[model samples]
Target: HVHGHFFALLSGYIDKFQLSEEWHRFTGDSSITDVRKCYGEPRAALHEVCKYACKFSDLDDPKLWEFHQGVNGGRMFDPAGNLRGVLTGELDQDSLEGLSGPYRDWVATWLWLEKKYHLQAGPPPTMLPYV
Candidate 1:
C-alpha cells in the first residue's frame, strides 16, 4: 500500500516536471525502490527530521562556515519539488496574512515585557548596547 501510494505520487511529480526520462535513467531498475510503513506520530517524526537537517552544534566549527558560504544565496528549504510552491509563497497567502496580525501582536507584547522587566531569555538588554 505504501509503495503504491509513493509510486503514484512520484509518477505525478515526474509527469508534472516532465522528467520521465531523467527519473528512469536515475532509477535504472524501477522495482528496486520501495516504501515501508513506519509507526509514530507524524508531527514528531517531522520535527526529528527538521532538527537533524538544521543541527549546528558548535558555532566556531569551520565546516559550518564552509557550508554557510556554499549555500549562501540558495534556498535551504525546498528549491523545487512538492514543497516548491509552499516555500515560495504561491500557496496559503490568505491564511498567513490572517496569522500575521496575531503573531505580530504576541511578539510585540513579549518584547515589551522583556524590555520592561529584565526577563533573561538571554543576556539582559543593557548588556547588549547595540540592541
Candidate 2:
C-alpha cells in the first residue's frame, strides 16, 4: 500500500516541475511550436502508456480554477532546483522508449492544462533570485 509520505513527496514534484508564471505568459500566446523554441525540449514530454497500474488520489480537493488545490496529496513539487515529471507503473528499461505517440502527447497536454489553469502568478524562475 502507498504511504501518506508518498503523497507529500509527489506534490513537491509537481511544484518543481511547473514553469514559472512569467514563462507561462510569455509563451501563453505562443503555440506549442513556439514553446519549443523558448524552452528547448521537455523531459518525458509525452505520456507513456500505462503498462501497469498507477495511482491517483484526491489529496487537496482541487477545483476547476484552483488547480493547485487538487494536488491530490501527491505533493509532487520537487525540492531540487531542476524539475522533472515522474512516470510510475511497471515501466522498465526497454518499455520506456516504446511507449511513445499519443502517450507522450498526453503528458504534454496535462502539463499545459495545469500551467494554464494554475500558473505561478509571477515572473519567470530565471528572473527570481534564490532565497
Candidate 3:
C-alpha cells in the first residue's frame, strides 16, 4: 500500500494546485498509489519526502509550523479552493541533477521568491518539530 500512499501524496498536491497536467487525466484500473511503480521511483526513496517532517515534527510537535509558515502564498490560499500549506517542488534531491547549467541557474534564482514577496507558503516554524 506504500505505492498508494505515494499516489495519494502526489494527487493530493496535483489536485490541490489545479496543476492542469494531462498526466492526471488517465483512466484505467490504475490507482494513485501505483504512481511510483508506473513512473519509476525506488520504493525505498519514498520516505525521503516525509523524513524531515517526521524528524522535526514528531509526536511532541506533530506539525512543523515554522517550515510551513516560510511557505508563503501571500494570503493566496482560500477555503473555497481547499488549498493549504504550500509545496516546494525543489526540496526533491534530484532537482538539479542532470540539468543544463543555464537552466539550473534559473531555478536557483526563484528558489525563495515566496519569502521575498511575503507570500508565505503556509506558516513559518520557529523551531524544528520533534520527529
- Stretches off by above 4 angstroms in model 2 are 1-62, 76-92, 95-108, 111-131
Task: Decide which is better by TM-score, 1 or 2.
Answer: 1
Q: Which ten residues in a row have the lowest lDDT in candidate 1?
A: 100-109
Q: Candidate 1 or 3, higher lDDT?
A: 1
Q: What is the lDDT of candidate 2?
A: 0.28
What's the CA error at residue 89 for candidate 1, in Å? 8.1
lDDT of 1 by residue, 45-77 (tens): 333333443455333457768877988998755
Clashes per candidate (backbone, < 3 Å): 0, 23, 21
Per-residue lDDT for 17-113 in model 2, tens only?
2333433443443222112221223222212222111223222335433655555577664533222454556543444221222111112123333
* Clashes by residue pair, model 1: none
Each prediction's RMSD to truth: 17.3, 19.0, 19.2
TM-score of each: 0.26, 0.15, 0.17
Error of 1 at 123 (Å): 36
